[model samples]
Target: MTGRTADPGLIGLLGFVIATLTAQLEHLGVQNESPVFWIGAVFGGVVQVTAGMLAYFQGDDFHFLVYNAFGWYWICMPGFLLGGELGFFEVAGPARGVFSLMFAILALGFAFPASMHNSVLPVTLLCVSGGLGLQAAGAFTGVELLGTVGAVLLLAASALAAYLLAEKFVWRTMRRRVVPLGRPWIAGDPDRES
Candidate 1:
């Protein structure tokens, strides 16, 4: 099960792009909410997890951690929504604010490590962090504008992720480096400055 395969990062990034765009569009009121659940559950959750597993076996620990964490995040979202909808547990605005803030912090933490890979990864992670922060602010302050801004940021992040996927998978398959992600900031070791 481990001969070789297309870079798992491509699959994970594609899944993230599709799911994030769908959820953000719903938040922006451009689409119905129903589709978001399925997209998050299947594409974001399952597909990303699969990619993470592949990365793990391929010895790409960074991608494995990033993809797995985000995949689980997406997978658990439906459960949280269901809990609120079914009245299993009350999720007040402040609670949701706290949750979003925590996730934002987590994304920021990952961004530092992601920066070692390439410019695009760090930028993508920063967008995700910023979007989550906006969402938190919106929930906490009851401001619709903040949420709208967050959705816009998420949409932008999704576009970036899609481009990365295309660059990594499609162009590479064609034997060209069409979209360069830029040089890694950390050079040899991800933990040490170069």
Candidate 2:
């Protein structure tokens, strides 16, 4: 497999940060859900999924899996909400819990493995998984606070992702790491930055 290309990781991180932050802001009542719908469909869906494909072409299987999974998540989840709002379909009550539970499971599965790479990946995954888990709890119990905490966790994840993207940009221009990505949970090669 080819391992040559402009970094798709940057694209994936950028999309992840934008979409997650926007969605979290909306979840916290700071932004309108309508604009978030577009952000999710385009930046979250198209850009991240395309980045996943690029990672696949680069022989980076882990990124291919992560970015694509979350890309589809952004697309499907937002579309489902938008569709419900438009009266196309209504998934309310316990059914919503079921749907959230499924995604929460997936996100949790990704979280631990992400620790092998860097603090960033694991932190992002754990935050997202925690957010989804809380969302599921919110749906099941009718507690808005659960969802609110979930939104805060998601915002934290987005902030971490944005830091990663900034780190890349600084490295590109300075030929040095100006913004550091913290150590991986599992130690890696001493020579490698991440």
Candidate 3:
């Protein structure tokens, strides 16, 4: 426990950002219908899911573990985006909604587990997943207002994390005086003890 363990929070943060983006894209009417969005979703999903699996094995109550597990949304979202972006899959809107719905389910399901271990990591991830779900619903349903909220959540989570990390590790120089010993405490030899 004293040694360093991989930060699962990164995966959580990834899921958060992606989820937020998913919501934002939905509002923008560019979610599954856009190739760029799909690319981002797929790439992000693979990273998150893989990280989550690793965390599961570590079995530490690190917050990152929860985030990674909930990241499966990455895989689902990209499928919708790809369908819309590629034109071969014409059910982009419905697909996005489906994935977004799935995100909500997964996010909620993992919430308690994360909270039971690490509060901040799980809370942030929850916010992100919720945002994604809202955005996806709005975008697919043509609700622009919900998209804006999603964007805000995304920005907020990122800003908060950055601030937390910066605050957590403050660099300071400590001045110390070096004391030199000219000779050993038991100077001449063992016979001196007598």
Candidate 4:
């Protein structure tokens, strides 16, 4: 099927990974400090790289595809690379916090785009937003406050898309309503007959 089709299972799986990682990262130990960071980095990096590559092959307008593919490659891949760097280890917390904002912008910017083409982008945006918001709250406020908000937003978007898809495919209901463009008319009134 085309990428445009609904993929609820995939969305659910990704959401699960995102939510679990977000939860695990909250209780940081020496061994497990930033587990969500690593998971997110890998998941995000691989996805961007893969999707970007696919976009390249699409051979549509080079500008948009190149922008999308390269943007992902630069943002997602580098977060992982920079996090793994030696200098980054010294200030891992601050570093991840700062760099996470960049990811937030990218994810949010693409959210509308994703919602337009596929259900994946919308969910991914919610996951990334939630995960990053958690990191940010933890960074600035010493509390993990945004996870619930993120999860809800992601879940809501998913439910909405699912509802739309169900209404479209299963129920086979009308997707739109168009009112006629004309003046109102009165029935059985002789003056309004014309």
Tens digit of lDDT per residue, candidate 2, span 135-165?
8899899999999998898898899888878
Candidate 2: stretches off by over 4 Å: 1-4, 188-194
Q: Which tens-of-lDDT digit does each residue in 70-162 have in candidate 3?
A: 455555555655666578666556566676667667666665554443345456556667766776777687887776776666556555444
The residue-by-residue lDDT of candidate 4 on 1-194, one tens digit each, is: 24553322232334334433443434332134355455544443344344444544543232234235333533453455455764563545555567656656665665554454334435646665665566655665555445445444545543443443343333222434232112322222221100
* Candidate 3 stretches greater than 4 Å from native: 1-5, 11-43, 60-70, 160-194
For 79-194, candidate 1 gives per-residue lDDT tens digits of 66767778997666888889888888988998888778778878888899999999999999999999899889888889989888877775546756778777776665543111
Residue 141 lDDT in candidate 4: 59
Question: Per-prediction RMSD in angstroms?
Answer: 3.3, 2.7, 14.6, 12.0
- Show the lowest summed lDDT stretch of 10 residues, model 3: 171-180
Alpha-carbon deviation at 56 in model 4, angstroms: 1.1
* Candidate models: Cα lDDT each: 0.83, 0.82, 0.52, 0.43
| Model 4 score (lDDT) | 0.43
Error of 3 at 1 (Å): 9.4
- Backbone clashes in model 2, listed as residue pairs: none
- Model 2 quality (TM-score): 0.89
Candidate 3 versus the native: TM-score?
0.59
Answer with 2 or 3, whichever has the higher TM-score: 2
Scored against the true structure, residue 118 in model 1 reaches a CA lDDT of 77
Per-residue lDDT, model 2, residue 192, is 34
lDDT for position 54 in model 2: 97
